[model samples]
Each structure stands twice: as structure tokens, then as C-alpha cells.
Target: MVPTMMLVADSSRDAHRREALCDLADAVARRGEAPVVSSFGTSDELESAVASVDGPLVVVPAFLAGSDRVSAELLAGLDLDQRFDACATPPLGAVPSIVGSLARRLGQAGWRPGDGVVLAADGAFDQDERQQLTSVARMLSRRVQSPVQVGYLDAWAPSVGDAVERLRRRGQRRVCVASWQLVDGAGHERLRELDATAVTAPLWPAGVVVDTLLSQHRAATARLAA
Candidate 1:
């Protein structure tokens, strides 16, 4: 029997968050896969979904940060049935195609060749997670042909405002903030408050997001089969 693909998303009050997850799930469904969406907002919601499923299960962490801790935290208290095989794939942030989508968003936001760029995200407390975010900024730098600095909305250092200010002090007349968030929420609101030339949209509903989720599902399914 085919395994059920479960996409576990971060909890957010933002309505776009639900739409984004549904869009991704729908995209997967269109590909003839069984896609189930759940959230970490409530343990019961996630647990119930798992209980309803039979056979193998593939859990995809839908976080843009791709932090393993986030995945672990989501599943920490869940009671997995011994009869069902279950496994999880890496978070969506690890998908390399995301850089390309970010570059396109930057361009759409009127980014110029020499404009300073800051990749703004909801900062992670974990050191390794921070490094992973920095790596994403480096990849984005190469794609946009500009120096991309990492900025945090919360949790870690160089705050979004500070990153923008640093770029301004460096004589960059225009600074653009590329949002590293998956959906519109507090992080995006924080980015808007920054003194920058422009703030690009979040990654929700992007084709890359759909593709990344599906790819992760396929990889997990293959691993389970082996």
C-alpha cells in the first residue's frame, strides 16, 4: 500500500499560513499523491491525523528555516503507532531551488544590480540553524550578483533594521530586504518596518515551494521503499 504524505507546518495566526499549506497540499494531490496537512499548533490535530492514517507515513517539515529541531519539536510528544512505518524528510529551506525563487522576487520588487540586499528571517536560537540561514544568504548572493547579508527579525543578531542601516552606512543608496519567511506574518510585518528601499514577498504559494514539498515526499517514499 502507498504511504500517506503528511506536511506538518508551523503554527501561525496569519490566514495566509493556512492557504499556503492548502495550496501545497493541493499541488501534491494533483500529482496523484495522498497529501495530508497538519500543524504543530495543536498536538491533538497532528496526533489525530497520524492515527487516521494506515501503512507507511512520510512527514515533511514545511518550515522555511529547515531546522531539524523544529521537526523534532513538532513530533516530540506524538504517540506513533508501532504498526505503521513513519519517517520524515528535511525541511523546505534545504531545497536549493528556493534561491532562484528569491532572486525572482527580488527582481520583481525593483531590485537593481548594485542595491544592497539583506536576507531577513525569523532568527533561530540554534547555532547550526543560524549557519544554515547564512548559507542560504550566500547562495542568494551568488544568484543576485550582490552581497547578501543575513538579518534576523527576532532571536539572533544583526536585526533586520541594523542590517539595513549597515548597508545604508556603507553608501548603498537603495537597500532591499528579501523575506525568508514562508508566509506573511509577524516576520513580514517586521521587515516592512525596516528602513529599506523595498521588501519582497514571502515564499508562500511559490512554485518552488510546491516542487520542494513534492520532491521531499518522493525522496522519503523512496527511502521507505528501500
Candidate 2:
């Protein structure tokens, strides 16, 4: 039997977050019409969401690369040891494979290696999650090979504007504002003030990022099932 799976996200904002939520639900629903749950506000909602299910439960955490504790908090509210056998796919925003994926997407979108890029994310205040996001930034920066900086749409040290100004000061002619926002939330509009040369869009470089995320989710959910 298919284990009951809960695809958890930080509410449905818009692009990828929206994509992830829809994909996970569809994946589970297609499997056998399993329960696909979401927690929008706090981690607490996850409890009620998960409680609605029976049998083995799988929690598919929704996060992009450079992720913060947003997912962690949502997961923490879950009783992993007893309530369900869980496997967490890290925030897609932080994975190196994701960077490669994002790079490929940008390449298709006329973004070259030296295009000054700001990998903007909606991060968290938790120290560990922040560290994880920082680690992801480090890994992705290597792939960028030019000037790739990390900034936040909400939390963290440097805001997006700060990152953009610094990069501009450093003589970056064309900057691509790649958002880690997967949801179609209001967060995407935050990039409106670019200096005409800055290309603003989702962090996705191409379709491959979405494909890889799905593959990884399946692999992880399978591992948890075992």
C-alpha cells in the first residue's frame, strides 16, 4: 500500500512553492489518491494536517536551495520517531545539484556564466537553517564562477538591495535577480527596482531543476518508505 504522504510547504506563495505543492499532491494522488497536506502559517498546522491521515506517513518538506529553518520548523512539529517514518528533502534552494540545475535554466534564458546574479531567498531566523542557507550559497557561488551573492527577501543579514548595490559598485553590468521563491506569492514583486540591465525571474535556470527535484523527492520518499 502507498504510505500516507504529506507534502508540506510554507503556504502557497506562487512559482516553485506553488509548483512543489501541486506536484507533490499530484504525485501522491496519482499513486493512489493519498492524502497531500499543507501548512501555511505555523508548524502547528502540520499536526492537524498529518493527523488527518492513517497508515505510514511520509512528510515531503517543500524548500528551495539556500533554505532556512522554515521547513525545519514545520517538520519539527511532526513526531518523526513515532507518528511516521519521515524523510526530508532539503530546501531545493540549497542543493549543489540545484545550482547546476539553476545554472542550466539561466543559460537557456540568455544568462551566461559571468552574469552578475543575486540568489535571493526567503530565509529564516534560526541559526542552523541560516547556516544551511549560507552553505548552499557557498556551493552555488562556485558554479556561478562570477559574482553570485546571497540575500534575503525577508530575513538574514544582507537584503536584496544591498547585494545588488554591492554588485553594481563592483562593476557588474548585467545582473539576473534569481528568486528562490517557488510560490506565486507577493514576494516576486520585490525585485521591481532593478537598473534596467538586471534580469529578474525565478531562480530556475531551466526545466531540469524541476525535474531533478521530482526525482530527488521520489528517491527520498522511497527511502523513507523502506
Candidate 3:
């Protein structure tokens, strides 16, 4: 059997967080796959458990929910020279699962073709990342008929508040703030602080879209196995 490393940032305490992680793992495992979920957090006591597994190590600092402390520490711990002994998958970018997630949320909330949405991502200080996030938003907007805007917080352009203001000014009252961040990352925290009255919070689809994303993992793992 070939050894493979898998990593997940299980950052939050919510059942959704745990379920999302487990669902991905179970899906992968059911396909005869085993991966090490490299975790970093002081809360759940799961990080230490994951680290002890004697296999190839792939670090997945939970980028789902914004990990301020983990990010700072992660930056210090990172290496560009393929320094880790195992292959760590590039963290989830804006993927197809995102679109499915959005559709589910918007549909449940009675979103129509013209409803406004903003897929909020972690605003990166790096200009390239900011552009990448913008592209993701654009792509998603096209995928769904509803208008989707890009929202950010610190360190990026088109800040969430600004995105909201722009859309509101444009006469979009039924706006959905769909968070594109993995799940528990800073984006979620920022998302939580938004005015629900102006922007619908039904856009938090982290819990809702886990199964669809799990299928993505299964497909990737199957491809690897083949």
C-alpha cells in the first residue's frame, strides 16, 4: 500500500466542524484511503491526537475558519523547500463544491435569479491572492444566475462592508453573504459580525455543503488510487 498524507484544520467546536471533517475522512476511508489529519488547536484536544499518527505528515492548519493564532504560528512553521516529508495538498481553493454549497443555501433561503450574493474569502495581503479571490467570485457569480459580489475584511480590497454598501446602493436588498472560507476561519468570524438585517446570514453553508465536498474528496482519492 502506498502511504499518503491528508490534513484537515479542525479549528472550531461546532458540530458542523466535526461533521465536516469526519464526513471527509469517512468518505476517503470508505474508498480504502487513510490520511493523517494534521490539526492545530488548543480546544478540542484533537490536534494532538492527529499528530501522533505514525504516517506521512501533511499539515493542514485549519484555514476554514480564520485562525489568527494558528496562521501566525503556521507562517513561522512553514517551509517552501518541500520540507515536509509528505505531500500536503494545496489547501482547498474556490472549488466546484463552493458553487454547490451556495446553490443549496440560496435555494433554501428562497433566493431567486436576481438575488445578490457575495462570496467572502480571506482577504490576503498578497495582491495575487486578492486577484485570485476576485476571480473565484466572478466565476461563482456566473455559475449561479444570481449576482455574486466579492467581500473581504482586512488585508484585501473590496472589503465586506464596502461590498455590502456597493450592492445595497445598487438596489439589492435581498443580498446573501456567502462565505467562501473553508468553515471555521476568520472569514466566518467576520461573516458573523455582519448586519443580518441588511445581509442574510443564511449564506453560512459550511454545514450544509459538507457532503457534496466529501464527494469531491472521494473523486480525487479515487483518481489517485487509479
> Best candidate, TM-score-wise?
1
Tens-digit per-residue lDDT, 51-103, candidate 1: 78777888776676633234445655665546448887656564468888988
RMSD, every candidate, angstroms: 2.6, 3.9, 5.2
Model 2's TM-score against the true structure = 0.74
**Which residue ranges in model 3 land beyond 4 Å of their true spot?**
8-32, 42-76, 80-85, 125-128, 184-190, 196-226
List, residue by residue over 1-226, the lDDT tens digit for candidate 2: 5555566766533454466456545644554444455555456667777666766666665555444346556666567666555555555545666666655545655666677877777776466566766766676677767756877876665887788878878888777766665444456666665552454455433445445555655776678666
Score every model by TM-score.
0.88, 0.74, 0.65
Considering summed lDDT, which 10 consecutive residues are worst modelled in model 3? 196-205
In terms of lDDT, model 3 sits at 0.52
Worst 10 residues of 1 by lDDT: 66-75
Off by over 4 Å in 2: 12-20, 27-44, 65-72, 84-89, 108-110, 203-226
Between 2 and 3, whose lDDT is larger?
A: 2
- Candidate 2: 10-residue stretch with minimal lDDT: 196-205
- Could you tell me the lDDT of residue 25 within candidate 2? 55
